[model samples]
Target: MASRFVDTHRDISYTKDVVRLHSHAFYELLYCCSGNLQYLLGVDRYQLRRGDVVIIPPGISHRPLFLEQLAEPYERYVLWFSQEFLDQVQVFCSDLDFRGGYRLLRTAGTPWESLGNLFAQGCREAERGAPGWQGHVCGNTMQLLVELHRACGKGEMPAPMVEQHELLDDLVQYVEVHLAEKITLEDTARRFLVSQSTISQTFRQKMGISFYRFVTQRRLIAAKTEILAGRQLETLYETVGFSDYSTFYRAFRREYGISPSQYRKLQQTQTIPPEA
Candidate 1:
């Protein structure tokens, strides 16, 4: 019942090279249908492969790293939701051990498999706008939570994700708190009391990408949010900390498969003007 007259597609393909990361103000769920990814969570890093489901809460910064030399493309079905969408279920299972915290749903067990299927079906139904598709998706989301709880209760919990390098946690926090400011690997490394090499190496190992790449990826994600929120690119680019137009254009085009100007052109709607 909560359809934005303009619903963005949940399926996405990421093939170009990108180095930015992003966090939402609302909850988002990602199911990796194929390929591998390394995700940066709050103070931790996770190496996610096929069959792994990642849940990113509002304000949690995350980045997707490049695939290995022998790896394939990274494609996934993602569902985005606001807090109000799932609050109704809180009353039904407040006492569950995994109640309020986010989790990574594995593809190994029966429960996770069910959740995957339900998610796939819900996306299909939502796209089709079947008789009660919105409600169906909302319902499937609740069921997925239930299955997650059952899996946790039965003691099939995956290890609590930990950043590969302990200091990488502090680094992520620093970058976000300073998202709009000028940031560089050397400056951050000095501030954190670590050598540039250590900082670069540790960040890459812990976050599955280099420090510079992570910052860029975060900026790109910020740009997308600004586009969705209907902001002008000239201001948004600076707001997200890009140094120059050429770099921003290259990063935006590479990350999203289209130039920023083109993206604005495609999303042009009279209701909200994306350009200043």
Candidate 2:
């Protein structure tokens, strides 16, 4: 979260017992107002209860993996922004890792957590003051830098932790761009003129998962994001490479902790739908 490069405050949505969604492009911060929920982050999945928060970073595909039966994917607020907005703040966080990721940084005083709360609180405070709504969001965004400084500590930022610099990022970026088309490792590796083993090995080395798994997770996430965005089920499913209806449904549920149809229905009644 202390990187000095370009990033965006990607999303800050309030869930009202509706569909819990995740995306591939940006980092996500889930601040639970109440209830319990499980999230699939990267290859390792985890859960969070009340007052619990989680961070999902770029390149790592994540989605809701579980939720309490009584909570209807509601009562949660999210602040999703890029880690790059803190170019100045990066200078202060010498102890943080520069390469960037969704590391579980102590949850409370960590750079991710503090900035998350600051952003979420700012978003809420902005709604209280109507005249400067836009400015309030903007100002709060700027304040996110200071929050990072406090959470990351004055220690020397850790070295970039990313292992594979090429394949993993390339593959994830490919998935994001080709979410609407059928994608396969053979075709993907062919585009890069590398062997399947190379693709698989490189992907696992950096992402800690197989290329195929990453692709499936990415596609399911794309379909989920599209559903949250109000796209038709069949259309989005096919667009993201699900060839069969039943398979799509099962895979979506396995990854998201809920059915696609249910998510779409909940989104319709909620506030602004999800955006990737």
lDDT string for model 1 (104-174, tens) is: 76765544565667668767877798787767777777777677667766866565455366576687778
**What would the TM-scores of all predictions be?**
0.61, 0.44
Off by over 4 Å in 2: 1-22, 71-74, 82-84, 87-99, 105-120, 152-275
Enumerate clash totals for all models, in the order shown: 7, 17
> Which of the numbered candidates is closest to the native, going by highest TM-score?
1
Q: Could you give candidate 2's per-residue lDDT for residues 1-276 as a string of tens digits?
A: 221232223242233333333454344556655544444455444445444445566445665533324444435555545454444445655544423656433344333444456656665764476785655655565566455444455543332232334455566667778766777888998998989899989855444567777777777766766775678787677778878778888987777566888766654443222332
Query: Against the hidden true structure, what lDDT does model 1 obtain?
Result: 0.65
Provide the lowest-lDDT 10-residue window in model 1: 267-276
What C-alpha lDDT values do all the predictions have? 0.65, 0.55
lDDT of 1 at 114: 55
Residue pairs clashing, model 1: 19-217, 20-216, 20-217, 20-218, 21-217, 21-218, 44-163
